[model samples]
Target: MAVIIKPFSLTVEDYLKQEEKAIDKSEWIQGKIIKMAGASANHNRLTLNLSRLLPLERGEQNYEIFVSDMRLWIEESQSYVYPDVMVIQGEPEFTDSQQMAVTNPCFIAEILSPSTAGFDKSQKFTLYRSIPQLQEYLLIDQKSYRVELYRKVGERQWLFTEFIGKDAIVELEIVNIQIAFSELYKRVKF
Candidate 1:
């Protein structure tokens, strides 16, 4: 038989118990907690633009929309993430505490950068896949007007679609919502 090493598992509760102090920023991937990188002005604007549209399209509904600063907990993989933009429907699942963590999200969007693109597309996307409630995952390019959408078709499969050009629009089938290209790249200087 081949040698097999069981993967370590870390729960949201145990992860929080490790550190009571808060750093500038951090992310939990698998069982490893990593620091978050600072965003550029363009990145910040794109993230803001995306966050602004969610609630408007969703209305005063039960969904929650969060920007870069918020943390999201993935229950399955036992990881916590801070996506550039996050939207969750239904009631707030997690309780309010000093070390609170988000358990589920219906949608998540990340603005791509050269540094984080690989992680976002491969590593981060792999982690995001573990979230059972994640319906759609979006990757927005700041250098150009390109939006890539991954809509879930089944429990473990995601359908990929890409939108290009400034006039293009991206639609999320999961949430039954559409957003303009201009809205995503608003105030974003090339």
Candidate 2:
């Protein structure tokens, strides 16, 4: 996350065009473009841990891994977000010719931070559900070894599961992958 602000609202097209040229990253929520918050060292470590291990669990041939640099656009919510970790089962649906913004993500993970935890759990999760291809959302806690997984079971229905402690295993049923809790929190100071 980076700190860059715009005083006005930007349309989807406008956001995409400007975001490409911008030095740092920002998100488009509804019609407003907001600056992204900075991530702590622990947050960065957790994101890297998962990003590095997911390819092995999900298979490099089947899933493509993306960290926060790539943008995910939810058409229904009219949002553009940079998730901590994202896995696409197959080809991604790009929002524009530039291929800078993605539309379809089978799984997404966000690192929890004091400044953004509430938004990630409530408002951001609400918007992410709008994507038909999204099957699971992982919220990884940077303060402790905890993960909250929300698996989509049916239309408008989601099942909640939690994994806590270092030895716990986080199961991603949608992708048939499992990750040890300790691996995700590796090198995290908190």
Candidate 3:
């Protein structure tokens, strides 16, 4: 006979309290707590490259960029996620008084991984769309020079753009920034 254990669920409050002291990060979706896996070398490199390339201040507009450590709260789905990179045009809105999780992000970028690529493109993207302040979403392929951009064109419409090859450039319309594939993939092995 095989032995099996049933999965347990945690409330939003319980999950937040536990996550505060946990060594590793985990995501809260509905009532389930999903542990986040460690990022790969290529993923880290891509994240760093993009973060450094984003200007802190473009003209009179000030922007705040956060790496992987910051948490993003999706109110519609009642979930929390840690994106690879998040860009806020102005001040960020926190979920609570603790200021641990942010609610508003104008631009978000995620480096695709073998394990989470599908989710990132589908379910995760759905949750991100619920954010009223989000304007652009970027998905970067760590294994190759490929990038996808989804820009909000209307209240319920989004424009999709894809860039391929090493010489291609990614244009972030919301922030008015452009980055070349070579620069974004710098120091990345694949």
Candidate 4:
């Protein structure tokens, strides 16, 4: 005889209720809530650097910047994710009538950690592409100054670019700002 066990499931409403009180962040997918690991020192530094480097120019045709704490809803997957950094142009669309989760992000940047790099590059990136208004995606290395940018050019086409070394600079086209790798890696010990 073989023994088997079933995974636990939760409705989106229940997941949100739990998430509101949870100390740490969790990703809700399908029907299960996956708890994310605490960010490393390097990861934390990079995330902060990335956010700080983003230009705060807001008036007309500007973007709203959000840190990782904000929850993002992927309508296609019915999953909620927290990107390291997010940029929303104009107004952001919320998930529920209560306006709990964001459904639109013009640009998203994810700081790569050893544990989540593979998932961020594959599943998470694919999930983010489902957003019709997403124009750019960035994968930034936490331990080093490597960055990969994907810019959406056509309806279904995307252009890829990579920048490396401390002297490199990534041009945030959506916001018309450039971020230097040196600045982005500041205070990052690794």
Clashing pairs in 4: none
Residue pairs whose backbone atoms clash in candidate 3: none
By TM-score: ranked, best first: 3, 2, 4, 1
The digit string of per-residue lDDT tens for model 4 on 1-190 reads 0111136778998988898899977888767677777778888888888888876665558667898888999998999988889988887788767766798998999988877888888878999998998999999987677999999999888999999998999998888888887788988887
In model 1, pairs of residues that clash are 73-102
**In candidate 2, how many Å is residue 33 off?**
1.5
Candidate 3 or 4, higher lDDT? 3
Clashing pairs in 2: none
lDDT of 2 by residue, 1-190 (tens): 4444468898888887788798867888998887886678988898889888776344554777889999898888878889988898878778778787788888999998877888889988999999899999999988887889999999999999988888999988767868987777778886
Count clashes in each candidate, considering only residues at least 3 apart in sequence or on different chains. Answer: 1, 0, 0, 0
TM-scores for every predicted model: 0.84, 0.91, 0.94, 0.90
Ranking by lDDT: 3, 2, 4, 1
Per-residue lDDT tens digits of candidate 3, residues 1-190?
0112126788888988898899978888777777887888999999999999998988899888998899998999999888999999888888888888898899999999988888889978999999999999999999999999999999989999999999999999778889999899998996
Model 3 spans > 4 angstroms off: 1-6
lDDT of 4: 0.84
Please give the CA lDDT of all the candidate structures: 0.76, 0.84, 0.88, 0.84
Error of 2 at 54 (Å): 0.9
lDDT of 1 by residue, 1-190 (tens): 0111234545556656653476545666677656665788888899888887776344455677777777787766667777888787876467356536576788989989887887888977888888778889999998899888998898788899989999998887656667898787889999
